[model samples]
Target chain A: MISQLFFLLLTSVAIYVFAKNLAKIRRNILLGKDIQLNDNKAKRWQTMIKVAFGQSKMAVRPVPFILHLIVYVGFVLINIEVLEILIDGLFGTHRVLSFLGPVYHMAIGFFEILAFGVLVACILFLARRYILKIARFQSPELSGKPNKDAATILLVEIILMAALLTMNAADQLLQSRGAEHYINAGAFPISSWLAAPLFVSFNNDTLVLIERASWWFHIIGIFAFMNYLPFSKHFHIIMAFPNTFYSNLKAKGELNNMASVTQEVKLMLDPTTSTPEGYAPPTSFGVKDVQDLTWKNLLDAYTCTECGRCTSSCPQNITGKLLSPRKIVMDVRDRLEEVGKNIDANNGSFADDGKNLHSYISEEELWACNTCNACVEACPININPMEIIVEMRRYKVMEQSSAPTSLNNMFNNLENNQAPWQFSPMDRANWTLEG
Target chain B: MSDFRVKTMAEVAASGEEAEILFWVGCAGSFDERAQKITKAIAKILHHAGIKFAILGTEEACTGDPAKRAGNEFLFQMMAMQNITTLNMYGIKKIVTGCPHCFNTLKNEYPELGGNYEVLHHTTLINQLLQTGKLSIRGGAFKGQRITYHDSCYLGRANDIYEAPREIIEKLDAALVEMKRSRTNGLCCGAGGAQMFKDAENGKKEVNLERADDMLETQPKVVAAACPFCMTMLRDGVKHHNKEHEIEVKDLAELVANAMEL
Candidate 1:
């Protein structure tokens, strides 16, 4: 009863802290401008299923696709056993669902197999990151904190799966000894084959103690991981679904037109038209900071797991340009988090810190982009770092009226003669005169 | 070259004749000396295919692709409206252009501003001609050559028109050697998003030069292009490696025209 009480207290505190941090993240994402991304409900759901659920985009990288599938499927399926643990923890019962008979044995057996797979997958993943040192994982953007956050999650999963298998091993041994509290509920297909022989000599009391210790450690690790999720890239396991749902549905080439600017331009075209009532000009152009972006952009930023797929596929980055799509996304989230904390500290109002997205993403990085959809195309969950880069470029050119000299010349000629160069308009048809 | 004159929309309208399509000869197609060769090739193919196409001539203005991409929305919309007014006045319905930038702007970007038309890149139209037997090829000079098609950003990834250009190359009796980065996975010629009109920001290697390397990797004897901007960039890229004399970067229209003996 005392142990059950302690379990309940620990579970409640972990869930409460996680929920609070999640709420703060939600608030930060909502700080951006409003845009309607929910236009097509049916299409959005289908997109979520295909891109997020099916992970169709990962097909490009076959190795990571298969390895990630093992970890993803095994880790998620094994968590079904956590429900049984939760019930057992709260009610102080051992294998409470053992009444399901063969069905319970089958599930426990499958979970054991999955737990083994999860442990192996995690070890391979750690090797890919730390041992083999894959180029995508070794980028400068994932230097300190991001690298630690990812490593910590994989290591924790290995430990958790080990505890689960160890718990099964000891419990099965206790059942064989016919210990008082031991239930012959689960079929330990994995642990029995691997760990049972070594533990066969242990006494029933020692077996009971080992099972209890493993059980407690396994459940406690789960609670700790639940909280760690809110602060780690592991959050992508949850965010990918919604991010894929609210995706860019138009042709990859078609940029979203600025409707406000179109209206003003229409008015400029016809001087006879009068301004409408409740009309206001925009105070600023494009995104200078996080608040100037759309909520969807913020969601995209948070959904990114720093996988570096976008960076690797980037034309500019591949050519050794200053732009890395991964860094652009991480910078957005970092700025959003900073602004979110500032608002929280100041009682729901932001205090200007003389910093914006421009502080992290350089003008050189912004200009280096080709506006190609490679990054948008490369992202498994469709995170659009290109959109953010375009928005920042809009801010620089329109708000600051600053651009490279050659581009300024192009803009001048476009204004004067309706072409990007200093050519005569009369010469537009000169080709018709030529061979 | 055949003494066949390209008609302006005004001349066609005055003569009580209507063209089947409006040839949107973009700024580069009109003014750039090198791109003008591509312009003439497209015209010759259309003329031989018996496709009655008319140009907007002096009436047509820029499509605002560079301005919009350079982050000048106000200027972009102004230019878009300017061209839309002229196009609508002529009651133009179907359009064809050799430049992918103009094709992208007219086909994808203009409809939202009430400038609706059936827009096709010149390669798509050429494919249509071949499919319908309007245009036939006998592989003139391009026969049995290993010609690699560099998918232009605007036409390939931008508008999903990869197969048309490749099909044209195949019809010319040429083996379509593909770059490692081809079709949807194609690399840019470092000339997209208004980069054509500006100096590239500081980088270890120029994008066009890297693309040139990708082209060279295929060991292609000829690099075929569809976009006028891509032609300039690829030509410069090929020249940078001193392979300009060895590899001819010809537009698909030029290849088709040469093959058809037009």
Candidate 2:
């Protein structure tokens, strides 16, 4: 009774918090006005098929993607298993897989295999992050910080999974040794094999206690992952579906128009509207801070799994430019949390509150963009860097009257002669004479 | 404002009711003598076909392509509106243009300013004339000379009309060789988007040079082009590369015109 009460209380609180955050994200998305931007029914359905289920972008970086897909699908399937664990911990019976009859054993066998595969994949990913050290994936700034918490979380998941598998193996061994066979053992061969070494020494009472303890630890470990998700890069596991569903469906290259300058100033001066309400002007044009991003961009910031698939494929980044598309999304996320904390504390604005957007993202970063849709196209979770980058350009061109010097002469010639060229319209016909 | 230009295609075509097609002798064809010769060639072809047409002379201003592409929307809108009015006065709905840039702007961009017309680049009309047996090419003028077609950016990429020009070249009996980057991937002539008016970008060799180099690699004796701008750029690039003796440039109109000597 006590265990049931404890499980209920913890799960209910976590669900409430997760629901609240999800609702906030959804509300902000509805208010962002991006849904009405474009219409292409065929492309939208094709995109859903290709991106969401086919995992095309993830497949571009094959090794990690395969690992990730297995683990992701496993985590999804394990939901029922985890529920069974919790129910068994409270009431003492693994009733969740109870419907499958003989196939329940096959299901258990599949879970063990996937869990082991996930463990190997996670280890390789960690090594890739820390050892093989893909240049785009590394954070130059994370060197001084204590990253032990990340390792601890990974370690706990591995240990909890090991415990769960061990407890299953031991129970199967006891049944083989003339113990009560509660479930059929047609498919769980590896679990039974693993149990052979320990089964002879353990009594029935000891096996039942070990199984209950493992069940409790597994349930707690999964719940802890659930609570940590919104704060982690793994948040994409929850956010990706919604992000893909609600992604901007505009023609790939179309840019959103910046708010006219006069309207921006009016909103800033008007006290009644200055408090960061939905899509209001001076509310923000370019992303000077995290709060300035549209709710979709913010959701995008959170959903990046830091796969570096975007950074690796970015032409500007590969060509030695300062524009790391992954870093840009990650930076926005880091800034969001920082500002979110500030807002919670009633500090009102961002860390670099009055700074211009250009100061945050370098001029080189802006100029280096070839406007290749590759980065956006490569993102598995539908974060569009082009949309934000172009919006910033619009603000610079329209509001700041600033642009690249190379383009300056082009603009100047255009202003005076009504062309990018120096020749007059009369001279344009000169080509016809020789032709 | 009335003196500024006429207003609408109806008014423009009304002024020239005898012609079924108004040949918009885009700025290039009117003043450039060689282009004007090609325009005269197209006129002769139409005359042979008995297709009635009239040229819109000095009354035609620039199509505002150069201005609009350079982001001068206000200037572009003005010129576009004026051009529409002048064409409308001639009762010109069916039109032909010797210039691809002019053809594209008239067909694609002019509608934004309330001037819309069925405009065909000269290659399309010439090809149609040849197919219907109204126009015939002698093929004896440039016999045995291998020619590669240079697809202009506006006529090729902006609009996907690669076949008409090539079909005309093939019919002329000049051995038509293909450039590796022909068709939609065709390199710019360093002329479109008003780049012709500006000095070439520093640290970058002219765009035409790269295009010329690609054509030279095919070892064609002649570089055939659809657009007048491309003809000038390739001619200059060929000279600069010292491939002038080995290579020469001709607009499709001039090529078809040359073959029409029979």
* The best candidate in terms of TM-score: 1
Best by DockQ: 1
Off by over 4 Å in 1: B139-141
Clashing pairs in 1: none
Predicted candidate 2 versus true structure: per-residue lDDT over B73-149, tens digit per residue: 33455566666777776656788888888887788766644577898999999999999998887746877779999
lDDT of 2 at A130: 76
True contacts kept of 1: 0.80
Candidate 1 lDDT, tens digit per residue, A1-435? 899999999889988998999999999999999998989899999999999999999988897898788888887788788888999999999999899999999999999888888888889989989999998898888999999998999999999998988889999988887788887788989999788888888888888888899999998898889888777788899999999999988778888789888778888899766777887876789889999999999999889988999998888888777889999999999999999999999999999999998999998998888988888888999899988988998999999988788888999999999999999998888877655
Query: What would the per-residue lDDT of candidate 2 be over residues A1-435, giving only the tens digit for each residue?
Result: 787778778777768887777664454333333434236766766776677666776775678788778777767776667767666655645445567676776777787777666666667767876789877656442343224434554566567667767777666655566566445343554555655466558787787677667766777777777777776666777777656765777434333323333344334345464434465444323444444557778778777777666776654455444777776776666656655655546654334445444556764555445444557767887888765665555455444656565555655654454344444644543432332
Q: Candidate 2: which stretches are off by over 4 Å?
A: A20-46, A138-160, A178-186, A194-206, A257-292, A347-352, A355-359, B1-262
